[model samples]
Structures are given as C-alpha cells and as structure tokens.
Target: MKSLVFRVFAVFTLVLVAAVSGCGQKGPVLNVYNWGDYIDESVLHDFEKKYNIRVNYDTFATNEDMYVKIKAGGSTYDVLFPSDYMIKRMIDEDMLEKLDFNNIPNYKYINDSFKNLEYDPNNEYSVPYMWGTVGILYNKKMVQEKPDSWGILWDKRYAKQILMMDSQRDSIGITLKYLGYSMNTKNPKELEEAKQALIKQKPLVLAYVVDEVKDKMIAGEAALAVVWSGDAIYCMRENPDLDYVIPKEGSNLWFDAMVIPKGTKRKKEAELFINYMCETDVAFRNTDYIGYSSPHTEAVKKLPAEIRNSRTAYPTEEDMANCEIFAHLGSMLKEFDRIWTEIKSN
Candidate 1:
C-alpha cells in the first residue's frame, strides 16, 4: 500500500510542474521596423501595456537598407515604414500583405487627400504616416546671397560647404531636376547627363550624409544642405539662423507610410498595433515629436497655429503645382543604381 501511494504522489507532482510551465508562456510579440528616430517611443510602451503584448522595435536609415534585410528573409518583421516609391516597388513585387480596414477603424481620421494616392490607390496595403517635400536648407549668416535655385549646390564659391543627401534616389533625382530632366527619367541620355552633373558637383560637397544633415546644419558646420521639409522644420527650431526653401526648378513630393510585410505571422496583433498608431492622440504625439506633416485631420487641427500656418510645414497647393511624385521605375532601378555608383566613384 505504501508503494502504491508513492507512485500516485509522483504523478501528481509531475502534473503540477507541467501546468506551471504552461502558465509562464509569454504573450504574442510584434516586430516593427521603421526609419531611425521616426516615432515617439512612449507610444510603444503604452501599446504594450494596453494590449498585453511585446513589441520589438527596430530602425533603418534608408528604404534600401530595409529592403535588403526583408528580401534576404533571415528574420521576420510584422510591420514596416517605407516611402512612396519603395512602397510601389514592394507592391509590384507582391512582398506586402493587404491590410484589413475592419481591424483599422481609426484609419477614417486620415485625410481623404492622403488616401487613394498613386502608391496605394485602393488603400489596401499601407497607411500614410508622414508626407513632406525635399528642399534646400541654408545658413542665413553663411550664405551672403539668398538661395532660390538648385544650381546653388554646384557653385564653386561654396566648395566644401555643401552637404548632399547620401540617398541614391534623392541625390540622383535632384540632380536630374537641376538639369531640366524628369526625376523618373529612364532615358540613358538624361541619366548620363544627371550622372555627369553629380560628378561635376562632387568636388564642392563637404560630405554625403543622411540624418547627420540635421546636426551639421544646426551647428553651422555646413552652409547649405539638401534636406526633407520635416528635418528643415526641426533644424530651424534648433537654430534660428537656418532657413529652408523649395527651389524654383521644382522638387520631389513624397510620402512615407506604414505597411505589413507578407511574412508577419501575427496579422491580428499587427493590425491592432497599426490601429493604435492611427488613434488621434497617438497621431498627435508622433507628429508633434517628429515635426512631420500629419495626415490625421483632427491631429492637424490640434497643432499650434504657427505650425499650422507655416508655409514650410504645410505648403499650399500652388506651391506644390510644379512638384512630382516619384513613380516605380521597375527595371530602371538597376540603371539608377549603376549611375549612382559611378557618380560616387568619381
């Protein structure tokens, strides 16, 4: 009888241990990849607390960097933030999953104008996060003359005082615009002209940079720089001597949006996170922190009058009439990359 009792006690102990281990299992985790310094991190903490889930956040400096990682498929990401042209390229390649609006009701707060855009016409794949234009940021004290044209980037007087974006598309596209060619030009001759223009201007550039443009410009390290409107806003706030202007020759009008990749295993959790980001208070926090143009109508109304009225932050339709949105280049992307390499090498 004592031997029988020992066997039953051992079985009960084993069952209890298994039950305790099962209870300790963690909740669902969502992985998010976005541009560096793009969001308010407290938002991520709040999301975790509200949903009882874990968030693994990561950042990339450029769309190309993000693309290479996702394409390599070594890791899984639940969400991504990519700009307009990259979104179109991903959609064309069937690399993204269609978002279910049923899970994203807060999407209604997004302005109608930001919807049905060329990148995601049906609004099935992505949600607009921020929109802005590319332009020149210059130091008023350093530049004796006002800069109103892209030609100023190539001036010999400013040699070693000019900072250009290291991005392949922005660098090449702006050079094409400066040369009176379409930014999306697939013509070999126009591309060659752009390559030559960049090669000619290379001698004048201080350094090719990305986010570093903000600190360098604010510290008075460079006289002029090619920058996004959002960065211009932040830099101007930090240093009153800085100013931004869209060149008379025209520039690229761009949008960056949040998307779900095809590999995400937690679609429901991913959609929940996206919906949370679209909430009015969350949207306001993100826009207020990043200083980017918000697509949320209610959030825009909540911004300070100065920001709402500022021409640099919210450009008028007339101001943007000459601007163009970048289209997916398909196979032409290879040619652009090749040209960018040659220009960099020279």
Candidate 2:
C-alpha cells in the first residue's frame, strides 16, 4: 500500500512540472495590422527572435477596410498603421489608446517636421511612419506633352488610357483640387461638383485600381494613372519610361502613422514594437524595401544619393506649398460614400 501511494505521488509531481515548463515556453503575442505591401516583413521575424514574442501580422488594402474590421471588434490588435485622416476619425470615435511615449525613446529619431501634426496634435496617439504626395504617374513615350497639371486627367486625348485610384478620397480629392477647391472641403456644392467631374471622367478611365496600379503601370497597361508617391517610385524603377508628377494645381500630402487601438491587451508590448520600428537600422531596412518616404530623419541619410535626391520620393517645400493634408470628415464621410457609389454605378 505505501509503495503504490509513492508511485502515484511521483507521477503527479512529474505531470505538474511538465505542464509548468510548457507554459514557460509560450510567449506573449502581438497583433499588427497594416496596409498591403507596406512593410519589410523580415522585421517581424527579427522582432520575434529578439523579444521571444510572437507577432501576428495582417494587411488591409485600404483605410476603410481596416476601419470596418476594427470597428466590428471580434479580434484584438495591438498596433495599427492608419493614414492621417483615418487616424483623426479613429481618435474622434475613441477607437485608439493614448500611447506612453516613455517606452518609445527611439521616437527622438522622428523628424520634428513630422511631429505635432493635425491628426495627432499632442503626439499622444500615434507616430508618423511614412509620408508622401499623391500624384500622376505617366508613361513618357505615351504622353506627347509634359503632364504638369491635374487638368490633364480630364483631357480627352488620354481617354480610355487613364487609370484612376479606386479610393473615394483620392479620386474625389484630386477632382476637388482640379476644380480649385480644398481637398478637405465639406461644402455640399464643392463635393457635388467633384462628384459630377468624376462621373464625367469615368467614361475616359480605363479602370479603377489599387495595388494593381504598380503591376499595371510597370507593364505599360495604361498611359497615365493616379498613384501614391511610393508606388510611383517602385514603378519608375521597373520601367524607365515611367515618370511621376504632383500636379501643378497641387495634391494631397498624406501620412501613415502607427497607433495602438483601444482593444490592445498588451500596451507595453505594442510600445516596444513601435520603438523597435523607430530604430534607425530597422527604419532604413523598411525604407529600402518599401520605397516610401521615411519620417525617420536618421534613416533618410542612409538612403542612396539618388533616392535621397529624387524629387519623386522627397519633394521640396516649393513643390508642396499649395498641397494640403487630408482631414477627418466626420458625418460628411457618408456623403462622400454616397457620391462614390453613384460615380461607380454611373
């Protein structure tokens, strides 16, 4: 009887030890949501190795798609990459958590110019990741005249050879600029005019595209396409005949920033991840891989001379004097959506 009791006790102790060891081997997890093809994902692996924490990375094609998923709220995300205007909307809706910058010392590397922007005025909720101007990407061989203004998108000469962004904000914003209205204008008259302009131009547009813009432009599928600066840089690399220009009338100056959402269960871990991303070496790797404008001042210095000097990648103040950053539209978003549906249907 004593021997049987001893064997039972020994087996129970061993089972308890094994369970504890298994628990110890498991690490914390962080969920990151970002735009498609926006990051050098190798950084995620390096982060996991360095911290012994697993990263669950996900991507969305647009800000709206990300917003919809996050708003639906079944899953939890520690970190998110949202553009300036969307950041404002999220903040207004109380969807983001205030970041404790004390853990993010590497934020010192961010350019002062990129800080204290309209979207996150106090720098409490977000960190600027990448920024650039929206512009027209055109094929030099196909475009006989120099494409300098947004007016060219309306020209009949390029009809059926033009590609527009599928995004409502981008398509409408540029049309607003072409009509001499603010990109962030809330006036119904201005918005209607912009909508009508798009409806009229739809017949000329070859297609409305998103990520496919890079592939299409590279293959010479379209003569002219509205493109983000980073995609323009990537396309220019693949096709020498490609050139990017911010219309003379001006364009949207956009920024994508990292933020912690309200549902984050691991605030400290998220802060650590943001700090790691702000590290100079990591920022350099991302900029080199993604071809977007880095807000990290130190990382910009590490880029090649041509990229550092490229007007398409880094536009000068004179180039951006008339440009404006997008602002949150609040209830007006519904109006924009309604118009967009009309444009697409027509």
Candidate 3:
C-alpha cells in the first residue's frame, strides 16, 4: 500500500513538471474585462489555481466605454462582459468569436428562457451571466407615498434629492418609456420629447450617477434613485428602509453576458474560464456576492430561499410584460448621444 501511494504521487509530480518545462514556456495568461464590482473575484483566483492559468482582469464602468475601447482596436482581452445591445452591435461588426458550445458543456445549466435571446438568437456569441430590470430604488422613510411611476422623479418636492443613472441608454430610455413610447424608439420626435423631459427634470436631479447610487441611497443622501435590480437588492439589504419598484408605465429589461473577442489567441483558455464560471458552485458564489440574478438553473437552486423567490430578483411575466429589451440603435444611437450631451450640459 505504501509503495502504491508513493508511485502515484511520483507520477503526478512528473506530469505537472513536464507541463511547464516541456515547452520551455510559462503558462497562459488570459485578459478578462468586465463591469466593476460585478463578480465575486475570488473565483478568478480559484480558476487560476485549478487550471494553471493566470488571469488579468480589468473593469469598465459602462457598456459604451467598453465598446469604444474595443472598437479602437488595441485591446488584448480574451473575454468580455457586455450588455445585450452592445453584444448585438459587436456581432454585427464581426468583433466577437462564434462560441464553440462544445467547450462549455455547462451551458446546459442556464435557464432555457435566457437562451436564444434577441441579441444572440442562435446562442452563437455569448453566454448569459447576470440578468435584471431597471427601476426606481427609493428610501421609504424619505417619501410621503410609494413611487410607482417614473413621473414621480420630476416632482418639485423631491428636487435635488433624486439620483438618475449616468448612462445614456438607461436615463433616456426610461424617460422614453415614461412618455408612453418604446424604450428602443428610433423616432426623432419621440427622442426629442424624451430629451426635453430629461432637461426639464435635470434641475430636480441631485446627480447623474452609476455605482454611487447604491452608496448614496444606502446613506440616505438621496430620496430616490434610478438603479438596476441587482443594485437595488444590495441597497435594500444594507438599509431596510429602501424599496424598489418597476414603474407602472414601463422600463427596460436588460442583462450582461460573457463573450470572447475574435482576435484572442487564448480562445481555449478563455472558454475554460467561461466553463469554470458556469460551474454551479462558482455561479452561486458570484450571484450571492454581487446581489445579481443568475441565469444558471443549478445556481439559482442554491440561492437563499428569500432571494431565490423574491419578485425583485425574479419577476413574473406579468410584471415584465410591458418591459422592452433594448436593440442595437445603430445610427439612431447618435441621436441618443446628442440628447444625452445636451441634457448633461444643460
């Protein structure tokens, strides 16, 4: 028995040493870019330990920023986490690699509903990471009445106490919805209305922010804020006085998914990391820490019952019936950019 154990250990040591020495080369390093504060991060170290690959992780604040960097053409990133519309744009531009699903067998664990999404109808270029809705996250103690409409944000009573998203798509898209238009509308007239509405409300807005919305809302610095459902969950947990509501008018339903860039030499290594991320245990750790909704069926089963069943985390179809998924705006996007600049400058 002692001889057998010693022999097995010797063989393992020889194979491990040969893996790095045989090629006179070091292990691969994969560059991954994703949203800030979006992952558990510890999982990256875990993946490194398990696969003998080093990860170089960086973060971007918004999808547009990410798109600009990658579009400028020097990024060495192997993996990315971009929202739906951006993914569609990347696919159309031939910026992404067609994923070989065979390398990511764990793809089967993702919920069927999250598959064949509008952006990747054939599931060709991306894997669903986290999904959620956009809504009003407000402090119950600061408001005289519950906020159920986006119109409430313009109330003079809440002037200088309302936080709005800094992102062009979310702020303007929500306004478009509030004005009884589609969040993805390309009509210049509708966009003008949305722009004017935002300009009108700008004086009431305390600030246009992103991640700071969570900290501000938690500290009671603002009475109300526009936030993603995941951020709302995190804020609500820290300060129970906070509550989130999907407006009666409508809102955008959005998600960020993982994809590989077309030029990556580390394609296999990238796929390995993606597969590792989808492992039930790894997926559970990410969602649990990030306060985001996981599309992994097995990981969803592992979440705490309270969060797993919370309507905020997983809204029923009726609640989301009116929600629109943003599509790639193409030239119409320039109109949005112009409007966003005007609103901010005003």
Give the alpha-carbon lDDT of every model.
Answer: 0.92, 0.93, 0.92
Q: lDDT tens string, model 1, 1-346?
A: 9989999999999999999766646888889999999999999999999999889899998898999999999889999999999999999999999999999999999999889898888989999999999999999999999898899999999999999999888999998998888888889999999998899999999999997999999999999999999999999999999988888888999999989999789899999998999999999999999999999999999999999988788888877766778998988989988988998888
Highest-scoring model, TM-score: 2
Alpha carbon lDDT at 133, candidate 3: 97
The runs of at least 3 residues in candidate 1 whose Cα sits more than 4 Å from the true structure, single-residue gaps closed, are 1-24
Instruction: Estimate the TM-score of every prediction.
Output: 0.88, 0.90, 0.89
RMSD of 2: 5.7
List candidate 2 segments past 4 Å from native: 1-25
lDDT of 1: 0.92
Off by over 4 Å in 3: 1-24
lDDT tens digits, residue span 126-160, model 3: 99999999999989999989888899999999999
Residue pairs in collision within model 2: none
Q: How close is candidate 1 to the true structure, as a TM-score?
A: 0.88
Check candidate 3 and list the clashing pairs. none
Comparing candidate 1 with candidate 2, which one achieves the higher TM-score?
A: 2
